[model samples]
Target: MLNFFLVNRLSSQVRILSSLLVMLLVFILVTVLVKVDTSTWTMEFFALSLVCVAILSGASNVLTASVFGVTGRFPLQHSQSLISGQAMGGTVSALAAILDLTIASNVTDSALAYFLTADVFILLCIAAYLLLPKITYSRFFGLFSYYMNLPDEPTDSSSSEDPVETVDVSSSKTNSPPIIPILKKVKVLAACLFYTFFISIIIFPTISAGIESVEKYTGSIWTNKYFTPLTCFLVYNFADWSGRQITTWIQVPGPNSKMLPVLVFLRTFFIPLFMFCNYQPRKHMYEVFFKSDIYPIIFITLLGMSNGYLGTLSMVYGPKVVPKELSEGTAIVMSFFLGLGLAIGSAFSSVVHLI
Candidate 1:
């Protein structure tokens, strides 16, 4: 029942939600149609296509991450790089939507199957790229550097300090280092993981179920479920773009702004909820689910918009909670939590369908 076309006024939060909604709706509908006949394709052919898409998407995510990381780390012109990276990420999302839609409509059975597979592959690839080697190195080094610099620790007496200055090296050693405050770090990591896990639990299952319902009732298959990925991609991008705009332009009076965190949390929760509510199972739901199709489409659009805004805000503000040096590391940990959450959600959703 959500109004799909209503353009909400632009707050930092609203701007994100609106964009996600618009992009997702367009991409999901178009992809669904394109994927309709892909069941006719051979699995081997389909898989090859998927691999190609995965490589492309993975490369894009890595490039975006690298740009952002390098820019953030640089002493000079960090802001410009950061902005450029975010913009690029947003552009990727937009491009993905367009490609998915175009491919969905014009592609033949074999072609559609290959395309869908590729999209999924790309998604997984992006995730893998985000998770592997560099994540660990960045996180460990960042945390290590932070902990090594704690003010609580006294200078080592062996190096040379006056007698008064040399006092109580033992107490200083017992005190945690200044750079990465262990307690704060733990709390942030825990919060990120917990939120990611729960949200994933809600989202993945709902999406899988929705796809299954579409397949079962509509007589579609995996390839025809292109809408799922398209919707996700668009929503993520739109929310991200909006968040960047909000944070950049809207400044609060105080040194610490309450708006950022509040907006970020709102962005995070709304998209999943929007998706869930739209696809909520009803009696004979499959029979009636696509009768109008309009309702779900609207939901998809809204979900995308919300996601776009929230994602962007989270990316921008995520590092601020920790030290500058540890930003990349924090991002890696957060990405891990996100991946784990998505995996668990997908598994659980599949199980629910079997039941």
Candidate 2:
């Protein structure tokens, strides 16, 4: 049974193959765009391109989560899987930030960053291929079939002659409720939509504003130099806390749990801090008072900390509240909100610059 579990736990080669195909499709699409129409591409094109990329990305994540959830070891071994995924995600985000910063610093070109991102993704595929040699797909499939066939809850029987009766009663009770309640599903869906809107209306604009401010004030377009990797680290920590807190709240066997509320409170405190830190004191004073202004380093630091906290909570708990089956769908919705926010914010910034 242990061996079977281990075998099934390994990610399938078919998944890796599918991911590779998706990557190839993305690469081809990008290559075609670059080669055929260089000057004609616009922000709308970029937005559409991102939407496709996001859909593929969301599909990949959903596949991974489905595999993990199938193992039925959530909040234990599954927690580790979730952490690994988040860590990898954070690492990729940090790399992207570094590349952006490096391009801004003139140490590398923007094309180089793009190339590196593609290359790294290819390398990940190769790594997956190499790792696949140790695990047999046949064994995994067999294990998966076996596990799926097993009853979810054990039978409770007092007599040896009534095995079929026992199984019938057990199955009836076990199957009485759907895995998720309809009300819970509605709540989760509503929460996901609310979060998506919140990101669009609040988070992305704030980020874009901060980036623009950093570029104007620091005379550098590399916003990551001032924020990215640092924010990523802080955000990941917050995500970690949020994931654990939500999992604990949901899975705890008792009624007197205080973990969920505490986690929420911590998450709330970070948002204001982020806003205050990125308040652009110098610009406000210069425009209003028409004088040399002082930058509040402490305020900025607090803002960074707050941003981290908010980011972590949103990323972690946001998905937790979402139905497991709809995690990928929720992520796609979130991505849509992010894209919308970025577009609005960027347009607003451009308008402000024009004025």
Candidate 3:
């Protein structure tokens, strides 16, 4: 909700750069405070650090909304690029965790390296945003400009008295235009997005993380330590990234196609697949139908792939379906649906874990 408001209030570049700057400051402060000795003021510093973390977390959604708004202006292929980049970040994080696990011995040293690396990355992003306007295509597309509305076009110039009809890009503009009509335009894409993420999040990290190798008792480091990270996180993230990249070249089942929703709803089957994997410490469900490691690797990979493909397709198609003026609003609405799906999925995941 805050994201929707902030995106409209500020330009895309401004909001993103501002958020990145704040995050950079928070990171520096946290690094300084947490490294200090544990004195009477330790708790005070810790509390302050938590508050800073919360602020950064709160600003994250706004940053996301702003970026999506910019991409919403351009062609759908650009949106696919942004989606692919996001998935690539996840893949990189998974790999970095594996690297940290292999090399870092002390938790303090590991955390220090982690936060410092993040700070540098934020700086890089800030620089990138500063340089984005230099791109010819970005300028040509007016990516930074807010589209108020498209000019009215007449169907027949000779027959009509006034060929080009006047559009009410009103002088007395409200904070936003009528939302009901906009909602009606992107309703199907929104639903597809919600269900896709809902299915993806319901089983991921909760049930999937608990899944163990069938050869757990083998006692090898590969099976005990590296198996889940490699097969689960790394593979899923890589496949997801691949799926997003594929959208740039091949966006099958077109924007208005009915097959899109059918394919999205079919992803619900992945939930049961993950649940039925070799989940450890099986308390309630006695059966583990997928008895081999290969099953989980395949299942998790497919889950991530489908999630990336369908999720990206749905989001890119959102702005395309609406009028130029309403693209920003529809983009924000699509983001809301995506978040709503994640929220609902997170809530359901807890229930699945308990059961």
TM-score on alpha carbons, each prediction:
0.43, 0.49, 0.89
**Per-residue lDDT of 17 in model 3:** 83
Residue-wise C-alpha lDDT for candidate 1, range 62-114, written one tens digit per residue: 34433343333333234333543554565575565566566666446645554
Higher-TM-score candidate of 1 and 3: 3
Question: Better model by TM-score, 1 or 2?
Answer: 2
For model 3, how does the per-residue alpha-carbon lDDT over 63-89 read when each residue is reduced to its tens digit? 776788778878888788888999999
Report the Cα lDDT for residue 215, model 2: 38
- Write model 2 residue lDDT over 70-133, tens digit each, in one string: 3222234343345345445654665666556555754335545565567567667667655534
- Estimate the TM-score for candidate 2: 0.49
Better of 1 and 3 by lDDT: 3
- Candidate 3 achieves a global lDDT of 0.80
Which candidate ranks first by lDDT, i.e. highest?
A: 3
Sort by lDDT, best first.
3, 1, 2
Backbone clash count, each prediction separately: 22, 1, 0
Worst 10 residues of 2 by lDDT: 288-297
Top of the candidates by TM-score: 3
